[model samples]
Target: MAIRVYEEQGIFHLQSKGTSYIMQIVNGYPAHVYWGKQLAFEEQPHSFVDLPEGPLFLLDRLPQEYPQYGTGDFRSPAYQVRLGDGSRITELVYSAYRILKGKPQLEGLPAVYCETENEGETLELELRDAYSGLIVTLSYSVFEDSAAIARSVRIDNQGEQPLQLLRALSASIDMPRSDLDAVYLAGTWNREAHVQRRPLGPGGTTIESRRGASGHLLNPFLALAAPDADEDHGDVFGFSFVYSGNFFISAEVEPFRTTRVGIGINPFDFSWQLAPGEAFQTPEAVLVYSSAGFGEMSRTYHRLYRTRLCRGVHRDRVRPILVNNWEATYFSFTEEKIEDIAKAGAELGIELFVLDDGWFGRREDDHSSLGDWTPNPSKLPGGLTNLAKRVNDLGVQFGLWFEPEMISPDSDLYRSHPDWCLHVEGRRRTEFRWQLILDYSRQDVRDYIYDNLSEIFSTVPISYVKWDMNRNMTEIGSATAGPEQQAEIAHRYMLGLYELLERLTTRFPNILFESCASGGGRFDPGMLYYMPQTWTSDDTDAVERVKIQYGTSFVYPVSAMGAHVSAVPNHQVGRVTSLQMRGDVAMSGNFGYEMDLTRFSDEEKDLAKAQIKRYKEIRSLVQQGDMYRLVSPFAGHEAAWMFVSEDRSEALAYYFKVLAEPNAPQRKLRLKGLDPDKLYKVEESGLVMRGDRLMAIGIGIPAELKDYYSYSVRLKIID
Candidate 1:
C-alpha cells in the first residue's frame, strides 16, 4: 500500500501510493530494487540496510583495493567487492579534509558499468571511500519480468559536534555515438518553454545554454562521445538532478536569502550542504534511448511523456475563459475599476475573473508586501471575500494571485521576523526585484504559508489560485544554518516547497492552481504535476506570441498553455496590432484576455464577444488536438503551424508573414497529416473541398505586405 514493486517479462514497475510516481523498467535494463535491510541476489547482486530509525542506509562490505592514479602527487587506493556467486561490484571512496588548496580530486575508484548481454544484465556496487563516515547502499529486488534499484547514501554524525556535510551524486555516462538531441520543457504562464539541441563539441553532443525562468541553467552538461584513450578529449558530466515528476519544484531559505541547485557538465561535480544532523534528498529519473534523427526522438519522447506522465485531469466543465487584471490594469486598479472590467468581461462571456497583484497589502508594485496575505484595504475597501463575492455576482468565477514564498524587506512579515529570511551571519543576503525569499524549509514557515493560503481560499468563494514565483535565488546563504549546512539548503528548500504544495493541493482539490514564475520561469514538468496550466509568457503581444507559442508547442500540449490577448501597442513591445489578430493568435491555446475590457471601444467589445463565442465552439478541438508544425518558424521570414484534432475531423492552421518580397506570388503550402479520403469544409467561406485535392494541390495564400500580419484557416472533415 505504501510502495509497490513488481517485475514481469524483464520489466520492473515501482509505484508509490497516492503519488504520481510510476517508474517502469524495460528488458535489458540494468537496474535492481531492494526492500528491508538485507542483501539479495537474483541475476544481479544488491543489498539494502536500515539505519538507526533515521533516513539513512549503509552498505557494509566491499571488494579489495587497487592502486589508482589521482591529480598531482595524491594516489588513492580503489577497491571493489564480489558477491557470494563471484559477481564484481564497483566501489566509490571519499575522505573529508578542511581547506585543501586548489581543486581536490579523487580517482582510481571502481566504476559501475551497465551494458546489454544476451541472457540478462549484471550490476556491481563497489565501495571506495571506506574511511569516510558515509556509505551508500544499492538495493534491488528482481520481479517476475524485471528488477528495481535504489541508491541511498548513509551518513553517520558520530562526532562530538554535529558535522555539516556536503553531498552530491555523480553519474558518469558514456557519451552517445551520434549527435544527441534533447529538449527541456517547462510550463510558463500556461505554455511550455523549450530549449533544444544546438551543438556540443567535436563529437556529436550539444548542451543547451538557456536558463529556466527561475534561473536554473537547464542541460548544462553535454559530451560528444564517450571517454577515449586521448585524455585531453575526455568528457566529464555532472548535474544536480533536482526533483522530477509532476509538481512544481521550489526552494525557500528564509526571506531574502538565496539557495541554488547547480548542474556541472565537464570535470563532473555536485556540491550541496547538509546541516549538522540534517539530512537532504533529491529524486531524479534518467531516460536513455537511441533515435535515428531528431524528429524521431521528439516524436518518441512526446509519445512516452503523454502516455506515462501527463494527467488528463479536466474539471470545471465550462472551460473557463479568464481575464487576469495584472495585464489589464497592473497596480493602478481599484474596486470601481475591477467592477467595470468584470461587467464588461461578463458581457463578453468571460467565465473567470482573476484579480492579479496589488490587490493585497500595500503592494502598489512588485517591490513590497510579498509575504503579507492580507487584502489591500486601500484598493478593495471591503476585503477580498467581499470583492470576490461582488465579482461572482457578475457571473464569473473568482481567482486570486499569491506569491507566498516572497517577502519584501519593508513588509510586516519581514519586519516582524527578519530571521524568517535566508541569510548567513556574516554573509550578505541576496535580493531580487526588491524582494526576498522566505525560508519555507522550516516547519513553522510551511505551516504559516499553508494556513494563510488556506484561510484566503476558505474565506473567499475563490475557485482558482494563481501561484507566482517571480525570481530566482541569488547571494546563496541561509542565516539559521552554519556554512556547511548552507550547502544543503537548496535541495532542502525545493523539498520543503514541494511538501507544502502537495499538502495545499490535496486539501483543496477543487481549487485550480496556475503556476506563474514571472511567466514561464519555473514551467517544468515538476510544476505541471500540480497546476494543470501555466502562464506561457509575460509578453502577451500577438506577433511575438506566434513564434513563442510555435516553439513551445514542440514539446507541450496547447491545453497546458495560458495564452491571452492583450491590448496593443502591446505593453511589452509597444507595437499596435489589431485586436482581432490578437484574439486569433490567443485562440490557439487556452484562450483568454488581459486587456481592460472597459477600456475597449464598443466595436472592440463586440469583437471580443464574437471571439469568445468562436473560442467556445472550438475549445474542445483545440484542447485535445494533435498539433502539427506544418512549417517551421525558423524556415522563412514567416512562421506557420497547424493543429489537427485526434480524430482528424477538424483542423486549425496559423500563418504569420513577418516580411514579404516585392513581387513574390502567393506561396503554395503543402498540408500534412490530413485525411486524404475525406472531404473538408473551410470555415472561412463554408466552401467544400475534397481532402485529396486539398492535400495534393495545397492552399495558396498571398503574403502579407507588412510586418506582423497573420492568417488563420479552419477546416472540418466531411464524410
Candidate 2:
C-alpha cells in the first residue's frame, strides 16, 4: 500500500492504498502525525508540555552498543525531516541500541521511536519491550478531501514473545482562550467513569487527565485573571457532545496489544503497549468545526451522525418481536409464570419468549449460584429443553440469559476451584453484589464456560441469547498468575469473553444475541461485532429514554437499539406516563415491551395491541431508512427526528414538544432527505403533495399540543 499526502481547500489529505485509509486535517487545527511506514514505530505530539523541570531525561538510558545481536540496536533507525514554511517536521526518528537479555525488565528490550509534524500538530510513537522478539508497526495518514479529519492509526505486531510497551500518542493545539469547549467519549471503568474538562494552570486545575495504572500528567494554562485553580469532578458540562461525538479507545493483544490515542481542545496525547506479534487500534473520532457553541455543535453532530453511522441494511425477513423476562421476572420466576407471560405476549402479537436469569441453578438473586449452570428445580422443574419445547409450541421462539464470565462467592464452582476467580493469592478478592469475576484467562476456565454454554444451546431449541455483564473490574489481581501476569488480566479477560462469544455465534449462527451490561455499560463496537442489537438502557421511561436513545443513535442505528415500552410508574423513575406515549417512543427503534401485559387494564391492552400492529406495518421502513435529526433533545425545548428510506419512497417523522410557550402557535418545520422531484402522498388525508411543495412550504405543525404529547406524519412515495 502506498502512503500519500496532499492538500486541498486548505485541508491536508493522507491516503494509503492509492486512496484508502483517507484522513483530512484543516489548517491551524492540530493534525494527527505518524511515522514508521507499515510495521514501524509511530508517534504524535501530546496535548500539553507538563514535564517536571529537572534535566529532561530520555526514557531508559541504553548503552552506546549491545553485544548480542549487532553493532547497532534494532531500536535505533534513520531519522528524516520533511519541513514546510516554519514547520520542522520530524517525519521519522528512532532510538539507538538495546537488547532483551531474558531478564524480567529486559525480556522485551528493543525500544524504537517515530515522530511526525503538521504545522503545530506533532506526536511520537514508540515501540518498547522489543527484546522479546516482537515486531511492531504503526500506520497513519491524512484525508485528501478534508484535512480537518484525521485518519485512524493501526498498530500491528509481528513477534514471538509477548511484550508490554507503553504506547502514547499526543498532540498540542493553540486555543483562543482558557474557556475552551471540549468533549470526550469513554466507556464505564470503575474509577474512570467521569471525564473532566478543567483549566490547566498556575491559574488552572490539573486533574487526572488520563486514568489507569499507567501514569499521565495534565498541566493547566497559566491564567491572568484567577490566582488559584478550582477543581470538581462533576463540573464537566458536555455529556451530549461526549456521548455522541467522542471517541472510544481500546487495546487488543495476542494478535495486537494495546492502544492510546489522544484527544484535546489544545493538542493530542495518547499511547499503548504490545505483546510480541500483537496489534492495537483506536476508534475514529469525527470532529466538526462550529462557532455556534455547544448547542449548535451538538445539533450538527447528531445530524451528520445520523447520515453516516446510523444507516444500515433493512431486514425484510420479519424479525420476531421479543419480550424478555429480566425486567419482568428478574431472578424470581417459575416455569408456570414464564408460560403465562409468554401466552399473554403471544396474544398481543409478540413473537419471541425470553426466559431471563434465575432459570439456571438454585439461585434466587444476583448474589449467589453463578457457575453452577444447572437449571433451578424450583423455577425450572421440567428442565430447559422441555421449557424450550413448550414455549416453541406456543408459536414463539424461546430465549435464555447467561452471565458466563461471573461467579458467586457462595457458588459451587467457586468452592471447587477458588483459583478460578480473579484474585491475588494473598490479597482479598473484591466482590460486587456478592459476585466475583471468573478468570477466563485460563484455558480450563474458558473450556468450562464453553462446555456449559454449548451444552445449553444443544439441549434447548432457543432462538436468542441475552449476554449480560453486570459489573466493572475492581481489585484486579489474579491468583494463578505471578505479579508480572496480573496487569494482563483485564485485557485478557475481555479477549476470553470475545473468543467465547465468537465460538458461540459461529456454532449457532441462527440464534440472535443481545448484549446487555447493566444497561449501556459495555455498549461498544467490539461487542456489536458479535451481537447486532443491544439493550439501550435499564431506564425505559420514555422521557429519559428520548435523550439516552438520541445520544446513542448518533453512533448507532435505531435497529441496533433495544427499546421497550415499560409500564409506568417506571421501575427506575417512579413517574407514571401514558401507554400511548410509551408506545410512540418505543416504535422509533427495535420495538418490544418489558412490563407485565396481564397487569394492563382493558383500555391499555387495546392500545398495546394497536401499537404492536402499527409497528409491524412500519417496521420495514424504520429498519431501512435514512435517519434525520431536525431538532436535538439537547438543543431546543422540543425533540424531533425523522427517517426516510432510500429512493425516498417512504418516510416516518416524529416531533415532541416537551414544554410549549403560551402563544407559540404552530412551528414551520423543514423536512430533510426528501426527493424534491418526486410526488408524495401524506397518509392522514390521502392528500397528494409534490416533493417540491413539501420541501418549499415545509410542514407547519403545532409545537406543543400538551406535555409529553407528540405528532407523527407518514409519507408514501408516488410515481
Candidate 3:
C-alpha cells in the first residue's frame, strides 16, 4: 500500500497490491491518466495527457479525472452547484493538496476507515470556486490488503452567503478507453439485483432511484469490463456507493471514445444549502479493479464488505437460525399464536423466534399503528415482555419488529403531532402502505422514536430486532426544514436515520439487527455497515431465490443474504418445489424458516430436524467459504453453485434442474477452488474422487434428479 506524489512530474500515484490508480496535474488541474493493473511508475507513465496531439477545445485536449462545468474544460461535470446569486456555473480549480498517514473520518456518515495507520493512507485535494468561495475537498483513501480505494467530497461554504449544491457526486473516473460493457443490478420488488450487462455508448446512461430509499429497481453498484470479459477472465472495474438514500450511477462514453464513470447523490430534486462555515459531505464510494475476471472481483467485494463494511459482534460471528412469523401469521396473530409457534420452533431446533409486524398499536393491518411502538394490549396481552418471557422459557431467543419511520393518521403519535409527518402543508399527503413518512430530519422526531424503542430494549429480553421501513418518501417535503432549507430535507433525514441507528446499535450491542425495507428495497452496503444482514427479498420460493441470491452474491457475502424456507405453493410465486429443494436453496444464505411449523407433517418435521442438525455441522463452511458460481441461472437449464472452505479442505455444492427433459444426457459437474492433488470423499456415499480428475474429467448428476429436483454434495479431503 502506498501513496506518492511527485511534484516535479505533477503526478499522484496510489498502489494497492496489484492495482494502481494514477492521476496527473495538468496545468494545475488533476487529469485522470490510468487505473488498472499496476505499472512501473517514473517520470513518465502511460497517460492520455502525454499525447502530443488533440482537439483545439480545452476539455477535449485533456483527460480529466473529475471535471466541472463552466470551467473552460467542458465535457461533463463531476459536480455542479448554484450560488445565492442565481449562478449555476461552478469553476473549481485545484487550490492545494495534503497527504495524511491514515484515513480521516467523515462525521455522521457510515464510511470505510483505516483501523490503523498501517492499513491505509489518505490523500485530500482542495478545489475552490473563487466566485462563491466554495471549497470542495476531494478525499481518497487506499487500503493495503483489500485494494479498495474510498472516495468522498466535502463542500464547505467559505463565503458569507449561502450556496445551493445542484450536484454532489461521490467519485468520478475518466478512462482513456471506451470499449467497455457496463454490468449493473436491476430488478423490482421480489426480484432485486438481477445482473444486466450492456455496452457503454456515447452520451450518458444512468441508473438512479428517486424513490427516497435505494429502491428495489436498482442497487447501488456498477462495473465496467471489456465486452469480451466473462466470469473467470478479463479486466473488470467495480464501483459501489455506500449510501442508502436516493443515488445516481452513470457511465458515459464520450464522442472521442473515452468513458467516464460517476456515482453519488441523485441530483434530481436535490439541492443542499451550504450555509456560511457549513460543510456537506457526500457518501463514500468504493473502487475495485480486477484483472483476473468477475469471479475474483466478487471475492474482493465480498471480502471488503464482510470485513470492512459490516460492523459489531455479528460481523464474523455465526448468525442464529431464525424463524420469522411474517409469512406464517402476518397481521392476524395473537399472543397465544406466537407462543405456540415459538414452542414448535424450539422443538425443531430453531434458534430465534422473530415476532414480525402487527404486535403494536391497532396494527391489525398496514393501515394503523405505525409510529406507536408500544405493544397492543389486546393482541399481545401482558405486552411484549410477558410474551417474550414465555418464549424464552421455551428455550428459544425472542425478537420483535418495528416500523419507526412511518406514522399512521389513526395512531396516537400522529394525531398529537400531525406536523411530525413529512408533508407540504396545503397539499394532500400521499400515502404508501396507508402511512406517512415521519420527519426524521427533525431531531425531536428521532429522539421520540429512539427513546420509545430503547425503553422496550431496556425492559424486555429481546435478543434481536428487525427494523423495517415499509415505504419510500412521498409528498417529499418536511415541515421542520422550513422554506429556505426545504430542499435539504431528504439528505438530512438520512443523516438523522443514521444517527438514530448508530445510537441504538451502540447502546444495545447485544441485539442482532436485520435491516428490511419492505423486503430488499433498502438493501445496500450503507445499511450493512450498521446491520450485518438484510431481508434479501419478499419472495422466498426456492426457484425464485436462485436468481435473487445469485445476483446478490456478486457484491454481498452469503452471510448477508437472508434466505428462508416458506410454505409450499409458495406465497409469492406459488411454485411448489420439494421441501429438500427449498432447504438446500435457503441454506446457501443466512438460513432461516418463515412457514408455520405447527402445520408441518411428521415427515416434514423430521426433515427439518435433520436439516437443522446438518446446517449446524456445515454452516461454517457455507458462511465463510469462497463461493464459485458453477452455472448461472441466466445461462442454462441448470443452476449450480459451490462453496469451498477457506483452507480448501471441505466443500459443499448445490445443483438444481429447473426443468427436466426426457432421456437427457448425464451432466458433468466440474468443481472449482480445490487442491488439484487432494483426494476427497463424499459424506453420503463413501466414494473417493481425486480433486484433479474431479475438475479435469468431472463427475455426473443423478439420472433420477429431474424437473425442479435438487441435490447437494458434501466433500471432505481424505488425503
Candidate 4:
C-alpha cells in the first residue's frame, strides 16, 4: 500500500494492491478526480474544475470528495450542521492534511483492522469552516493485500457554543458516468438477504433501516455494477457500512449523468449535540472495486474479513459441528430429554450441544423471564452446573442461549426496575414477541447486565454463547436522558452495546460467541467484530436455504455463516426435503444440526453419522478455502458452487436442482478456480481428468435423479 502526494499541485493518490483513488484541491475545496484501475501518480491529473463552464455551473458539476449542503451541489451532502445563530449554510475549505503509516481505530465503534502497521496506510484531510469553527476530517485507509479502501468522517466542534449535526455520513463518491445498475440485498423475517437488482433512475434510489437495527428488510450493502455484469465479468463497486444500527445507502443520478453514492448512519430522526471541544466519529464504510466481476469482489471480501475483520481464536480454527435444541424442543425440554439428545449426538460425532431457551426463570414461553438470567430449578432439578456437567460427561461440550437485551414486563427484573426499558411517558411502549427493548444507553442498565452475565460465565463451564435479539426498537426514548440528549438514544445504545461486548469477549476469550437478531436481522460487520459468526436465517429448509445462503455470500464469508440441518418438514416453511440435500447445504458453512437426534430412525442415524464423519474430513477446506460461483440459484432452478484450497491441491464442488425434469438432455457442470496444467481425480466417479478438461469440458449430471436432488464431487491433485 502506498499514498502519494504532489505537494505543488495539491493532488493525493492512494494505491492499493489493484486499485487507485485520486483527489485534488480545487479552489480551496477537495475535488474527486478518479477511483478505479491503478494509475501512476501524475502531477497534473485531470481536473473537473478546469472544465469550460460558468462559476456556479462548475461548482455544481465538480465531483467533490466530501460535499456539504447549501454549497451549490444539488446532490445529497455528506454532512449538515446548524450553528448557534440558527444558520444552516456553511462552506468548508481545505486547511491541512496528514498521512499515517497505519489505520486509526474509530472511537467506540467496530472497524476493520490490520495485524501490522505496514499492512496498510491512511490519509487524513482536514477541512475547516472559518466562520463557524467547524472542522471535518475525512479519512481513507488502503490495504497492502486487498483492493478495499476504508472511509470515515470525524466532526469536531471547536467554537465556544454547541452545534447540532443534522446529518453525518461515513463516505460518499461520484462516479464519472451513470451507466450502472444498483444491486443490493433485501428481504424480511423468515426470508433474508434476497438479491435485488435494478437500473438507476433519474433521481435517487435509497435503501435504509429505521428500526434501530441493520434490519432484516434491508441490509447495509449496496453494489453498483455494469448493466451486463455477471458472476465472472464486468466492473462492480461495493459499499458496505460497518455498523449494526440504523443506516442509509443511496444512489443518485444527476442531470449530467454522474451518479453520486453515499452511505452511513440513517439521518432520519437522528441528531448529535456536539459540545465545544467534543468530536463525533462516524462508523467506517468499506469500498471495494472489482473489474473481474461480482465473484471476484466476493472473494476479496471473504479473504479480508476472514483474516483481518474477525478476531479471536476461532477466527482461524475450523468451526465446531454442533447441535442446537431450539428446533428439537423449544421452551419445553426437560433435563432428562436434553441429556438423551446430547448422548445421541455424541454417538453421531457432534461436538457441542446447545441448550436454547426455557432453562431460565419461570420462562415457559417468550412472554416472561427474559431479563432474569437465573436457571429454573424445576426443569434442571440440579442447577446449571449439574446439568452442564452431565452434558459434558456425555462426551459433548455445552452451549447456552441468552436474550440479554430484552425485558419482559412480567419478569422480576422489570418489576424491580420499572424504568429500565426504552419508553416515552404517556406513550405506548410497543412490544414484539412480548418483550421490550432494554435501554442500553444508560450506564446502570449496562452494568446490571454485565455483572449478571459475568457471574454466569465464571460459574458455568459454557463453551459457547448464542447472543440473540428478538425484536426491533420502538419509542426510542431514554428515561434518564434530558430533552437535549433524547435524540442521541439510538446511537448511544449502539455505543453501550459495543462497550458491553468488548468487556465480555475479553473476559471470556475461550468461549465462542454467535450473534443472532432473530436470525439474520443484525448480521452486519459490526456484530462480526465481537462475534465471529452469525445465524444465517430462521428458515432452515434446504430448498429455501439454497437461495438465502447464496444471497448472503454476496458480502459475507462462509466461516461467518451458521448453517444447520433441521428436521424433514422445516419449522418455518413446512417444506420437506431429503436428508442428503439438507446435509449438503449445511456443510457449505459452519456445519451443524438443530433437530433431535434421539428421534432419528435407524437409517437416518446412520446417514447423519456418515455426514458428520465426511464433514470432518473436508471441514478446513470449506471453511478456509477460496469459493467460486458456477451458477446462480436466483436466475434458474439449478445452483452450483465450489471451494478450492489455497494451494490448489484439494477442491469440493456441490450442485443442486430444486425440481427434476423428465426427459431432460444431458448437462455438464463447469468448475472454477483450478490449475489448468495439473491433473486431478474425482472421488465420486473414481476417474481421472485433466484440470483444464474438467473445468473446460465439465462433468455430467446423474441421469435419473428425483426432486431436490443434490451432488458433490471431491477433487485431489494427481501426479
Which candidate leads the pack in TM-score?
A: 4
Error of 3 at 236 (Å): 0.8
Q: Which of the two, 1 or 4, has more lDDT?
A: 4
- Residue 295, candidate 4: C-alpha displacement in angstroms: 0.4
Put down candidate 3 lDDT per residue, 103-132, tens digits, no spaces. 888888888766788888988888887888
What does candidate 1's lDDT look like per residue over 1-719, in tens digits? Answer: 12232333222222211111122221111222211112222343222211232233112111111112221111111212222233333223422211111111111111111222221222222223333223332211121111212122233322223333322322322221323222343333433343333322232222222222233233222212222311122221112222321112111111112111112111111234323344323243222222122222233223323332333344323357999888788899999899888888999999999999898889998788888999899998998888988999999999998899888998998989888876666666677799877886677888989998989888899888889887766544556666545654554566678788778887888888887777766655455556767787888977767767776654455666788999877888787777777887898888998888888888988888899998998887676666666665555677666777767888887777766578878786666557988988988878788777777787776566766677778899876
Better of 2 and 3 by TM-score: 3
Could you give the C-alpha RMSD of every candidate to the true structure, in order shown? 12.3, 11.9, 1.8, 1.2
Best by lDDT: 4
In model 1, where is the ten-residue run with the lowest total lDDT?
A: 103-112
Cα lDDT tens digits, model 4, 568-590, are 77999888889999999999999
Query: Each candidate's lDDT (Cα)?
Result: 0.54, 0.53, 0.87, 0.92
The candidate with the higher TM-score, 2 or 4, is 4
Task: Judge candidate 3 against the unseen true structure and give its global Cα lDDT, from 0 to 1.
Answer: 0.87
Model 4 has an lDDT value of: 0.92
